[model samples]
Target chain A: GAGVSQSPSNKVTEKGKDVELRCDPISGHTALYWYRQSLGQGLEFLIYFQGNSAPDKSGLPSDRFSAERTGGSVSTLTIQRTQQEDSAVYLCASSLWMGGPEAFFGQGTRLTVV
Target chain B: SQQGEEDPQALSIQEGENATMNCSYKTSINNLQWYRQNSGRGLVHLILIRSNEREKHSGRLRVTLDTSKKSSSLLITASRAADTASYFCATDALQGAQKLVFGQGTRLTINP
Candidate 1:
């Protein structure tokens, strides 16, 4: 796809189970970001990955939340021991590079933890 | 905390009317961007205004930036029913890696 691609458009999981969301950025894009949006609320920055540089994880809500980017391409966001509060649409975006051209977004993955 | 905060949680107007939305930020930003989301799907970039430039125009969309006040406004002139969507303002800080801090957003409903 020409734009960012996210896997499992919708996911339903048990409260104590773990869930993994995937993101594939546009070809040649070096900057990728992850954000979470709860119903009727603003987007919450979760993590960022820039080509080979250390990802900024300042926005991850808890120790259970983690993410990784391999080969500077595909990325995955993992939530361990998910809680009901973890339900939200997880969005992924990628830009040509960091802080420059506008980023392109994926449709996002809506996760529901029951 | 989110850096950008948009005013008027929601707005509704008829077709051909103009719509305006405001956003305020706390810190110095290198740039500000507007994005539109339809049906809560992926966001589409609208326009971007840099700190150096006070205003920019893209078709019917006009954007203004005030650095001293640390705020920006997005205006959609001659709107249509197709314009109904949620608009968000995001700020790229002067110092950070290209991470964008987004506001809660304004839900705009344009009646046909």
Candidate 2:
């Protein structure tokens, strides 16, 4: 079975630029989540989507951080006006709802804001 | 914000030796999960223990949870050099809507 997949393994951009990271969840997975990992730091929750319900954006660091999961399958995380603090590994995960409770992760997109 | 804090930021052990890591978290949780990440790779789920359950096992990995103490521990038996990686503990807090709050992580180095 194919696992979660993310595109653009690495991205380098200037400050104030915008970047988009893409994630494709496994087939039949209904729960999707995005997290950030800074160097030598813990995983930081960013956003989550479950089915057609509203997405949880509480963990988003700022208004510049936004994510959208379209058609209940693929998702894109966009950081508008990126800052050096936003530079980190963006990870995507998918699960069969919380009932199953095991999340499959993607390789992640390493974003570098110079 | 991170809810869990792992002890011993780094550890080194000889191959075939056992290793243990502990995590302490604030707030009640629905479940506690352990994940392993190789260098420059995505995290892989190791084991999960519900707040109600005390312990879980997957192959050489063993996880124990103590809801009273708001803590959890992961023990790896007969660790191999390939097992060298970073381990993290994540908590599914009772208040959060199924989000996993992770700890700072422990870097394990298995010396062969």
Candidate 3:
């Protein structure tokens, strides 16, 4: 796809289970970001991968949330021991540079933990 | 905490009427951008205003930035039913790794 691509548009999981979401960024894009949006709420930054630099995980809600970008292209977000509170739409975006430019977004993965 | 906060959580206007959304940020920013999302899906970039730029225009969309005030506004002229969507303001902070921080967003509805 020319734009950012996310896998498993919708996922339903049991509480305490784990799930993984995948994202494929645009070709040659150096920056990728993950954000979580709850129903009727704003997006919360989760983690960011920029080039070869370390990812900034300041926005991660807990240790259970972790993400990795392999070869600076495809990325995966893993949630361990998912809780009801983890139910939300996970959005992925990619940009040509680190900042100061428009970003391309994926359709997002709606995860429901019952 | 989110860096940007949008005003008027929800808005509805008649067709042909202009709609405006405002966003305020907590810190210095390199640039501010507006995006629109439909049905909580992928968001499409609308416009971007750099801190050095006071205002910019793209088609019927106008964006204004006030660096000193740390605020920005997105004005859509000639509203249409197709324009109904959730609009969010994202800021590229000057500090840190220069990641974009998003605002809660404004839900705009246009009636024909």
Compare the candidates by DockQ and give the number of the best one: 3
Per-residue lDDT for A2-114 in model 3, tens only?
78999999999999999999999999999999999999888899999999999999999999999999999999999999999999999999999887488999999999999
**Residue A5 CA error for candidate 1 (Å)?**
0.3
Of the candidates numbered 2 and 3, which has the greater lDDT value? 3
Error (Å) of candidate 1 at residue B103 is: 0.7
Is model 1 an incorrect, acceptable, medium or high docking prediction?
A: medium
Candidate 1 residue-wise lDDT, B1-112, digit = tens: 4379998899999999999999999888888999999887799999988889999999999999999999999999999999999999998888755588899999999998
Task: Please give the lDDT score at residue B109 for candidate 3.
Answer: 96
Q: Can you list each candidate's DockQ?
A: 0.78, 0.65, 0.87
Q: Which residue pairs in candidate 3 collide? A: none
* Displacement of the residue A111 alpha carbon in candidate 3, Å: 0.2
List TM-scores for all candidates, in order: 0.97, 0.95, 0.98
Q: What's model 2's lDDT at A40?
A: 78
Clashes of each: 0, 0, 0
- Per prediction, the TM-score for chain B is 0.96, 0.95, 0.97
The deviation in Å at residue A27 for candidate 1 is 0.8
lDDT of 2 at B17: 98
Give stretches of model 3 more than 4 Å off.
Answer: none
